[model samples]
Target: MNSHEGRPAGLRERTRRAVQAEIVATAMRLFLEHGFEATTMEQIANDVGISRRSLFRYFGTKEDIVLGDHAEHGLALRAALEARPADESPWEALRAALKSLFESLPYAPEEFIKITTMLHASPSLRARQLEKRQQWAELLMPDIAARLGEATDPMTRLRAHALVACALACSEAATDAWVHSNGTIDMERAYDEAVAAVRG
Candidate 1:
């Protein structure tokens, strides 16, 4: 039998997750220190004490290493929304879900500022961020539609698109304001204000 055969499935999955988190953390540190363009996969692997091949197995590209955690956050957001009481309005559910999601991130406001700075300084990274946001929208759209009791029609898709667009715009605005203010402003309050502005 394989070495993992007798082990609990959760143990194997947790181990995999821990390794992946280490790789991403190492890559983020290197990118922040040396700039995204200057950090190579080989350097990350060396820092993480893993083979370059193993790094490639975890992340197909340097951008993937940087943004991999966002994928997990997206899933968490979906789960949060799904678990909301059925009587809650779509907007209320989305707001609560997003708050929970942001609260769960590993970064503090200072660290988030550094990440935002790195992303803004790199053209490729900024592009990749947009692509990942689009993917997040696509991942959430189906669930949003179902919650709205809408069939899979063109109109329903359009409504889902609009909701995701507005929500993301609000989030971006909040983060931008927080970063520009040197994190003196409360991010959660800023986010809530942005959502309220859009709601009016």
Candidate 2:
């Protein structure tokens, strides 16, 4: 049984969140200033006023800094999908999750544009991010398979994969559109449009 399940969660959870947020903040600053490849773990550690070993306690590698919370994002999406009305279609549930994500970000369009730029500018990071997305797909696949039950044959898995791929592709397209429009367009709208196109 999870300790957090029963009690009102306490200081440890708060501390963990604050520490993780600080790590991401510090790492993002370094990444933007020096470029991802040029930034070193030692520099990040020094900048954060910690030993290299200590930094590793928070993040094992530089790539991990960028992709660390990606798994958590998947989990959140799953939770969001689960919360949608039981009668909701999978695509509809996924659309709700996308909307929730777009709404949850605190950054301005310019900031998000820069993040997308940085991710693409670094080849290794891009590859790593893609790999992470694939890993997320695998994590999600089982749930989708179970949802489809006996109907979830190989062809069903293929369709489910395609749906997941389509969602991702829409997200990327929306980001590109957001960047190109210079904060003029609504990202949520772009995402909605992409999903609509894919569903159609």
Candidate 3:
């Protein structure tokens, strides 16, 4: 077995992540309390007990703070998709994959709502989130393509693109609805409905 296979994060790395999480938590509270546009980097830094420069070292911008480490893009989706039954149809497989990926995320819906609500309210943040989603779509294409087959054909490539786009759009719609409802509606049920509507 590889010596590093199950190793825990080193102290420095753990400390770094702790601080990063603190920054996001602090920044989010400040943003929610004060409004995104009204909050300043210095305010976030002071609240997080870090210098403004140190805050920059952790995050490049307020948008980055709000979005907070886009994470390993589509890894959960890729793994979930890969684990899906091979015989399932494209739509069903994608639907399952989307549901699985949504369920596997670490953050709670309340946190997601705050962040997503903030993202929707800010045009620049929305644009940045779209850029992140595009990156996710690009990264997720090959895995989705492999599942849908015909990887060598241009049309298959297009189909994979469509599937990814639709799946992401479903995700966006579900989250938008969930945030709109202030988390009162069932996001997953909304997601299932969106997929069903598209798959019909």
- Per-candidate Cα lDDT values, in order, are 0.84, 0.78, 0.83
Q: State the lDDT of candidate 3 residue by residue for 1-200, as single tens digits.
A: 67775455576788899999899889888998999999999999999888999999989999998775664546667677778887777667767877777676667878777877778889989998898888878877876777778887898899999988998898889889888999999877898888888879
lDDT by residue (108-170, candidate 1, tens digit) is 878989999888788988898888888878877777777677648879888877887788778
Model 2 spans with C-alpha error above 4 angstroms: 1-17, 142-151, 196-200
Choose 1 or 2, whichever is better by TM-score. 1
TM-score of 2: 0.81
Residue range 52-136, candidate 2, lDDT tens digits: 9988888888988988877777777677766777666666667787678667776676677788789889888889888887876
Reference-based TM-score of each model: 0.85, 0.81, 0.86
Best by lDDT: 1
In candidate 2, the residue pairs with backbone N, CA or C atoms under 3 Å apart (3 or more residues apart, or in different chains) clash, namely none
Q: Considering summed lDDT, which 10 consecutive residues are worst modelled in model 1?
A: 142-151
lDDT of residue 14 for candidate 2? 85
Off by over 4 Å in 1: 1-15, 147-149, 196-200
